[model samples]
Target: MKNTLLLLFSLFFYTMSLNAQFQKATAPVADKKEHWRNIHDDKVLDNYYWMYDYFGKGPDSTKVVDYLKAENAYLDATMSETKAFQTDLFTEMKARIKEKDESVPVFKNGYYYYSRTEDGKQYYKYCRKKGTLDAKEEILLDVDQLAEGHSYYAATGFEVSEDNKLMAYGVDLVSRRQYIIYVKNLETGEILKDAILNTEGDPCWANDNKTIFYTSKNPVTLLSEKIQRHTLGTEPSTDVLVYEEKDKSNYIGVGKSKNNKYIFIVSNATMSSEWRMIDASKPNDSFRMFQPRMKDVLYDVTPLADKFLIRTNKDGAKNFKLMECPLGKTEAANWKEVIPVRKDVLLQGVEEFKDFIVINERKDGLVKLRIRSLKDKAEHYLDFGEPAYAANFGANPEYNSTNLRYSYTSLTTPSSVYDYQMVTKVKTLKKQQEVLGGYNSTDYVTERLYATAKDGTKVPISLVYKKGIKKDGNAPLLLYGYGSYGASMDASFTSTRLSLLNRGFVYAIAHIRGGQEMGRQWYEDGKLMKKINTFTDFIDCGKFLVAEKYTSTKHLYAMGGSAGGLLMGAVANMAPDLWHGIIAQVPFVDVVNTMLDESIPLTTNEFDEWGNPKNKDAYFYMKSYSPYENVEKKKYPNMLVTTGLHDSQVQYFEPSKWVAKLRDMKTDQNILLLHTNMEYGHGGASGRFDYLKDVALNFAFLFTLEGISK
Candidate 1:
């Protein structure tokens, strides 16, 4: 009887231990809600005094107002101090890296170039070469002046004629609904003609240089149609209907051949694509579709003189293989493998010259430029051992045959432009950029950690901090991620993040599923019906951080924007206890509603990524985790939700409705701030300084929650 009593006592102890673990994971939600309420109430009183002091009148204002302002200022100062203290503590524990490098890449040119400003401004800068690796800039056009009448000045590709007489560039003024093909005189820099075209098209230079070929929407169905031979001085001509995409699934575009005999137009509907050959000799000739018999083929085809190089996944491998086929005779059976797929490597693009073809490939996360001899099939690889993410190789305009330039960059590294000689295989560094002051990469380190998810899947988490940091639970941890659309969240340097790091916070990237980090299969597994894996993986990462004592739940903050915002929404809803605060910018929270309506823009195109909600199973799956639909009566953490009024992708209404729903359903009176930019598109904060301010506010909120200063 005594032994039995001892056995019962052992069982009771085990159950208590499990319960304690559960409570430890969930105790932060109540504490966070209480803290947020206190902060919000105090801030309200502080804001009242600040407003009264700024606008109040009379001679006695100096006396009473000064006292009130001083008291208010004290509170504000205390909040700021609290944030700083928390930041410093995190910095001490995590060894935060917040150094900026002076050497980076800058655009060097003499002409005024139009580019997008951080504050959603269409600004033009006159680029002048100062010396080798140095350039001067002057403002040419201000977006604020032009942004009044027009929504935005979206700049696309620009092309100048061989004689430098005329220049042409494409611009999508608003939401890609109206595209304008603008032609300009190079000498005067005045727009000669701004021809409006349908959505989904790019301008292609004709052989005659005076005329251009492009595609646009059909007036009847408003579907994509091909238009050719539109000259500068002629009247509006009839569009040659190359390929009519019946369903909304197909995409159409025109490509000019090197020989200029046949115009290659591709039609892609769903995952499969068909190349149609159009006879340039006869403008009215019918287009014949060249269908290839390959399963799961994904490619972008570029034409050469005699043969066309196809950048595609024709082989049963993860990477793309370059296949060579004769022009106008490219069929499934006619394709000959020119470059075989290497393990853990992908060939990106190919640029052909007279005797050789230059192929860009990524091996072991590093980019290499390979030259393949067309005559002897010999391959020569150029070794550029840098953490380069994306690269573009261009032949010099002065000596197109001899000199080539390649531009590359990584996360921590700025862009570098190098000029290479094909014959000599020697590279000359042309330019390096200087970003800003007070940043150094050597002071910090970036490391990858794998954590087990709810399903035992290993999720890769990237941590960036100062060296020799202790594994303490006191650090203010900011975890960021975007897990969707097979997009890999590559490591890249950011100047704005230095402010948070310097304040003593631990920054992390959780590479959950729905991204292409592990491979294509990883993305496929996480998307569609398996989308719950993304939220679970992120939660697992948070749990692992707490379990390892890297950070506590009370000091952890989560962030995501755009599609990543969707990630933020899901995770916040699933495990609000694990996060002190969340920042969701332009999130797609109404997934079931958005995907169900085919009338919405780009809805059909995304059906492959997120399954069609018409099916009952898909509807159930999407509705189950939809953030807007799943706001149960529960205490939510402090959240800052932002969106742009001009955002075309995830419309502002989604966030507006989401904030409303969250406010209605939330039990705790937590601060749910919704900041909407009136002029910006999907990206908020148009200016660099404005962006910095927004980031500072976000960090300030997180720091306040950690009780750093107070």
Candidate 2:
């Protein structure tokens, strides 16, 4: 016992010596190479522009790599003290999840399809049962086995042929979002030779079973530019180019109707959409244009038995409305309003069934599922019974069935799946996420609060904490925000979040603008020239939390990813003192520079969302808040910035350059760590359990700042 104590004491001293060495180590200093650009008479200088040379394999490629490695090494040395804590957090969070779990099976076609994970596995196996739920199980794809040797592997677009004899799926080993479609003979258990590369990973199978359609992407820009149709057993080079999008700004894809009667080629931009349709049975026939692209009218067609239902923002329907047209008359002039535009409700989408239709509506930042009878036009909504919860349609593939599968969850409730009878209004709980190690909803408390923005707009904030926790200023709180692309940040439940709640941390989600939570106008008011509202909304929420005694400025932490990372960068620049620490994951921080480069992936496609910077007005507006451009010599909060080496959406150089500049300029000697995953992309690790490690590191960063060590 005395020797054990002596050994522990020696180990402690060794660790302390390493910590002291890391503290004395110098941070990596990025070289300053002058690069200037002038747009609309505005000239600017960029010192870190050379970081973008990595992808081009230019002279500075090795230098960029060496610099990134140095920063990573610096981060390792600085955070070496928290290494064991991060692993402990990972194990703690992973323990709450069921090792072997299966999804609730969904009845589709002639089989009940589901995916199940195995013990100690990082991926799942796709399985199905014939006819009845008790029938013999057939394994379609064992993703675990397929991903065995690959460091990063993603299998998506699982499209089974209408006959159920074959399956077509896309695989991405590079983690760049570019997938290669492969065909597998499910009945014979044989993999086919048909492989198509550089696709968007969306494989749409035609009714004939011998043909498939997929959207092809540009190799360099990674833009979905062409829809190609390939025949079974034929070389991919011989694939027919069915449709090619001329407008670089519009993103295009090919899909089939849920009823399997028609194949569609959809081209959509931020403000407009166009669609073309061809009979699924007639794969060789030319596609007929249902509607030509309009200036600002965005619409989508849902095929009904006798007519086509068009959900559109036509005729100034800001919140959108449902319009119907006769089977043969699909022109805009022939369309008649079935559901009028509501000022309070936003018609998010619709799911079509033979006898009924489900309308997904959002009002007051909450999702509402309204069932309408196609035969009688009667309508009713499914009750979720929670003020701040996320409810949405699940996998309801059978167009002839009356049952609607929907999922519901709140900040406190576990994700629950339910199948509701549209005719009888009866709902059956299919499954709720099994949080291993036990979890009780009553032990937690959730609240939906509104924080007034600087412009007087009421931004919604959803928060959750332990039941016994007091609303005092001493608690540590993490405020998460993602206000971009009209994607609503709903209050959803995750078992891993319990770790934070159990650790006396309050978690809050800021439903800021640039999202369609409130309404379409809410999004319009927060994007383009008004993009400042998103940053200010997040800052206001942080301040509001402090004012309400949920947390104080000293304990407040902020986190965001992708576009939300842009938010993190903005808020840090605009209001640094509001947060003690910040986490920006795969952040789109170099906005003006990224927007000006059309060759970059997603740059040309997001012109309407972020604005085209070539124009004089937009050039100035974007530069004003562009994180990397606006960074100045000032005190800033401790920040942990993460990026993937091969991120297709937002390049890794953005975060790398941003961090280098922050290190060079920031006055405060706060922790500024940059973690670049050398093997992953925008969405980090592909394995189910592997992502938890990153989460653990993030939580450890926050815990270290809060001085909470386990």
Candidate 3:
């Protein structure tokens, strides 16, 4: 026995010596850069496997945990070195905008207006009476001093009566579900009459201006019903059911004809929408379906003397085309196509003028306006090259008899309102939103680039940064993106982003799939079974930025909200090494669980967007990418997960349970902070300043992660 024990001891000692020697040999030669590259490549291969493999048979929990720990370590180190970079960025931004005034909305002369002030507390001048700074600023309504009950409550859809006697506004304070239609006496500042109506849909005023027609949904029946002829100064005299939509989709009241003869309604049941016309004169009448077989249809109908002017997608192209339809017709087939659809161009804003229809078209990313005469075959087109978006035709009050007004903006431009005379063919700028005094657009440059995804699909990315910025590879990058639904992330100007861009750090927007950046087809390529593409696309974007030496993986941070948050969570799991830090605000991370249950509100409608998980196919697909379900032992990066306790859209429990699960599974001791706002909803912040401060905090965290600042 003694001989055997001695032999075993000798063997153990020999084994220990060999292990120490092996550690010494491997430790110094690890080559962290090469090691990280191999790990990332392995993760990419694993992600492809996870996409196709059966949900129940996936990566082991231990493997996931190790990856997350590695990710956390990488982020922590990167954040430590770049703390000063972000501080410089924010400091420079504040210095640039120190002298500029903030802008606010004001209500005056029975119309809602805006005011800009160098200081936030004082109003400088009214928007309409700009250039007359010496004139005392007029106060139309003292919103703060108004009685609590009688005060306007979060008005959104504002419309003034024709005679300007009544101010009709929609308010929703308690719940976003219901909207209160309040008609107030403009002269007396008294609540003339208010009705609790369906706030989920838009509200329209009747031609007479005395009656209001709106759409509401009955929760019990789960049907969208129309409430017509709710007269002012009295209770609803008619409870006319214009149409009852049986599909569990949204139905909205567009508007009534100028003559108040017909009411137009649009119903989106699933991927497609249909337009219907109802005779307002016949209260008990059923709606006449205009285009039942139209796919991806969007139209704005305006009443004309004999025929109705219509803008629709009847043309085989993706852009809208102007057409004319006989009002008393029985079928949409009777409509005459006035403007043919063009293959390369997209018709945007359309409005009816005295004798012509003004149409805006998008050609090669530039916006041009064209006016077509209804009486003659004459057409006039105007080009304003600034990458204009969200163009709307507004009638000029001064030249209301002949000309129209157009408002548009781009990346560097603030909103500009322009008046165009149809008869004179001249355009004049009426008003331009001025950025606070010291802020300048010339300091930053905007560029568009494409990142190649795993499947070789080119994803568009918009980068905004200070000109002549160093390409040190250590520069901080805050990448933002949303890859869900058919929502398009468009190019628009933001004063708030100035706070980041001015700070030397680069800010980028990744236009991934699942968004309508390219079109509906693009969205479909990234949803459902293709959901993994969205996460992979984001990871590829980060990799591309690093590969191009624009920013190192250490200084790279990512952020997204709502559906975008879901993107952040998925990418965090798949390639945590690519990001130093992540911010997910009001995320829908608990996909499989939330989608499987129908009892949750808005579940039925969302099922069409995100497939019903009860089905075997959907269960496999959803479980594959569900962040909460896929959580395993991993080294996750420093993550700040935010949620609103009152968020009715994405339940608060999702983030709560997700954080708890992540805490249990994570192997690394990385910071995983959960900030829940008790008062806010899906937005997470309440007031404007409060939202800005929250944004600052997020930027602070990101900059800190990039070693920019504490």
Which candidate number would show the highest lDDT if scored against the true structure? 2
Comparing 1 with 3 on TM-score, the higher-scoring candidate is 3
Query: Number of the top candidate by TM-score?
Result: 2
Off by over 4 Å in 3: 1-142, 146-153, 175-177, 217-229, 233-240, 257-262, 278-288, 292-305, 309-323, 339-349, 360-370, 380-382, 386-404, 684-686
How does model 3 score by TM-score?
0.75
Per-residue lDDT tens digits for candidate 1, residues 334-399, read 888877777666676776655667887655434568887667877788775543244567433331
Candidate 1 worst ten-residue window by lDDT: 26-35
**Model 1 deviation from native, Cα RMSD in Å:** 11.6
Order the numbered candidates by lDDT, best leading. Answer: 2, 3, 1
In lDDT terms, how accurate is model 3?
Answer: 0.62
List ranges where model 1 is wrong by over 4 Å: 1-122, 126-151, 172-177, 197-201, 215-229, 234-243, 255-264, 277-295, 315-318, 341-343, 351-404, 420-423, 467-469, 685-697, 706-710
Per-residue CA lDDT of model 2 for 453-475, tens digit only, reads: 98898999999999888888999
* Pairwise lDDT winner, candidates 1 and 2: 2
How far off is residue 561 in model 1, in Å? Answer: 1.8
